[model samples]
Target: MPRLPYLSGVAAATAVVALLAAAPPPSGEVTVSRPRVVAHFDFAQGQTPENIALEPDGSADLTFSAARQIAHVTKQGHTRIRATLPAEANPRTPVVGDDIVLGIARAHDGTLYVTYATGTRKTGVWRVAPGGAPRQIAQLPSNGLPNAIGLDERRGVLYVADSVLGTVWSVPQQGGTPTEWAKDTALDPVPGSEGGFGVGANGLKVHDGAVWVSNSDRGTLLRIPVRRNGSAGPIETRATGLGGIDDFAFTGRGDTVLAAMFLDNELALVRPDGTHTVVLTQEDGLSNPTSVAVRHRTVYVTSGAFFTMRDPNLLLADLGERHDR
Candidate 1:
């Protein structure tokens, strides 16, 4: 773990932008009263980050599509390439989307699970073990396209949200056929906007006993209750009106759900009451943020330039930055 002096979170936030102005390369960590830009990367010109996950030990893993790679960012700010996902294996799956990762998660045993789809071969899921090569874990039916991945640490099950198929399927964490947990055709893409199945849902996380799914096109966060048998309850919409929700994570011990709105590039906090607070806005310098994770009161958001047209960079905000308290 990279150790930096623990300044008051406030002090760290205030110094970040000032420090950025004085530097050539971005300094890795930024501390603020609450919101600080701890790390920033310029998406290698063409490539952009899709998702970001903080390792239990405090390091971060980021996935980039245009660059065809995944990188591990140390707590101290150093980034090292971890893997080059075989985009060459299949072309159907996007290289990256709105900074949403190819899908990165850690199993209970600290094994990293990364999932990406190829446009060519839509039936397969890739499993890459730590210090090992990538292997094909399962090949689904012809029409199945695996989008986002989530892990049920206790049960050793992996949840896949396939927007293309309008379904959420759970596979054994070790790898196998996926059982449908929930599905809604309403989420496919609208006829004019982007075009697709209408529902743009993916980016899944298992919290408490429920699997929270981000419906990007409909702009809502859903909680699919996972029973003991791993089947699901009626799909419950947890919060709505988020602009194009993509992916999100729990914050501060998992009390609040911090969701990233892909269209608006906003980070919205969903309280238990189903109400939301706009924690970060594009005006705060976020553009197409796809995934969000909270570590020790700090919110780490990853965003892409959006396709080949937008500016791609990762934004770190100290959650307390805007709080005067």
Candidate 2:
């Protein structure tokens, strides 16, 4: 196991709440049925809200990648900083060019685990307890771009998806060296990805006794069996054709998923049968949505606005009568 770095004595920042307005739905899409916006970014809050985790009280904890902070959103639609990443955690590599926090997941006990990259070579995961400074938990490989994370609390393990390396890694919940749990050709980048990022295994989730992941470039969803012996088994394709899939959450129905299609500027409802429905689109006011979180029948989405970095927002809508089980 690699030696874990102790990040201590980093000054924590005070929480900042911002006043925001309800974003009107995009004009032309008015006739098209889709999820409506409940909360939109005020720009005074933060930019590039990435991944979100649902709190016990039904609020959401969001990662603001560009701002390098974790924010909490109340169920009633208010936003505030929950924690801030220390300067040392920011990556300084040329490949990625900027320090960005990508994925966040909450444990049952309320600890938040985050994946961040300063560059491809400086990727790591941090654990942040409520009202505490972030602590480095594991250091990923220098060549891997750590993105989304998933927790298997029952097994006391954490799973991280490395988009650049096309691999999934497992780390001890208590903090230790990460091991490559699974990798396959299906996790590779699809031909002709626009950006140099080459995103492969992006979003991750542990559900139904398996580890599910999405390949952003390929837009493929796959699952790896978790054996009784605590090892990962063969990988299997669950669904595909979800272009530019980023972070996603499972829907109320088994085998159904709500995914954020980043490049397509849409929200997608995908099933194991390879059929997908565009629940929201650019015309519906989604601008480069990077993540999705579902709590009961309501769905929350974060638009990073990566291209323009303008009008980035957190949108919400109820899972109404449209979806099929």
Candidate 3:
């Protein structure tokens, strides 16, 4: 999804929230993280970290969206470019007209997969093998905006969320022809910035036995079960009141979610019962937090600074801190 500058969308978002003001009741008590900045980015160099895939060794693979590149960052904050994507020839993209990379996922064998959206001939999913060049594995719709990607390692398949077209596509982990895995009005963008590119289904994750998706425009999280026949089952609205949600990751604590709300500059702790709490915010060095990844008791958050256009960074927080309420 082409992002709106924080300046342009804040007032509109505030007005919308004021008119539809309601919060979900908290499910129960839970401990949250206190975030601290670990690494910073320079926007002029196109170093915005859009999504993250953590390695077994604690390093991170990131999609530098708008940079058209995939990069890696060490646990100690050292960063380097892995591969730069091909330039879009006819760069007329929908929404913000950016021909950039979006989501990324790392395979168990260290093979890295990323999504590119140019709204042109180059829009597709690309694979970057270990010590190899990036190659296109699946061709998505040029008119659609493919955002976050999720890997089902057990099934050897990948699921992509199309924010513009409101569809979730399925492709082989090794790259093949894409298939429309699921379609519903529930995934369509009906609110927020950009008329044609409201960008509904922005983030995706294949957790447990279902494909979990975040609807940015509708302010809800959805879960679609994968049936025994490998087809999409029923769609369930898992959470609500998350107006500007972008990408999210599940913590080890049994179905709990840590989500990034880029539009609101907030990190939310969403529980299994669809209730959530604002655990971190702009005060925690967040400038439009985009993605979240969890490893043990540590949480990784990527802030692209798309709205602030300043101080794009990686923030870390330690979990397991309990607060009774």
Please tell me which predicted candidate would have the highest TM-score against the true structure: 3
Ranking by TM-score: 3, 2, 1
Query: For candidate 2, lDDT tens digit of each residue in 1-325?
Result: 0000121111011111121233442332211244666567744544568888999888999888867789898867688888887654545532355677778999988999998777644468999997788988898876667888899898999999888787899999989899988988787664433432366888899899999999976768898999998788999988877666888888757877888887667787676576676668777778778888887767888887764346777787776443323
**Candidate 3: lDDT of 309?**
82
In the predicted model 2, the residue pairs found to clash are 91-118
Per-residue lDDT of model 3, residues 222-280, tens digit only: 99999988899989999998887889998877788999988778888888888777778
Error of 1 at 48 (Å): 1.3
What are the TM-scores, per candidate, against the unseen true structure?
0.78, 0.83, 0.92
Q: Lowest summed-lDDT stretch of 10 residues in model 1?
A: 1-10
Q: How close is candidate 2 to the true structure, as a TM-score?
A: 0.83
Of the two candidates 2 and 3, the one with more favorable TM-score, higher being better, is: 3
- The clash count of every prediction, one per candidate, is 35, 1, 1
Please give the CA lDDT of all the candidate structures.
0.62, 0.74, 0.84
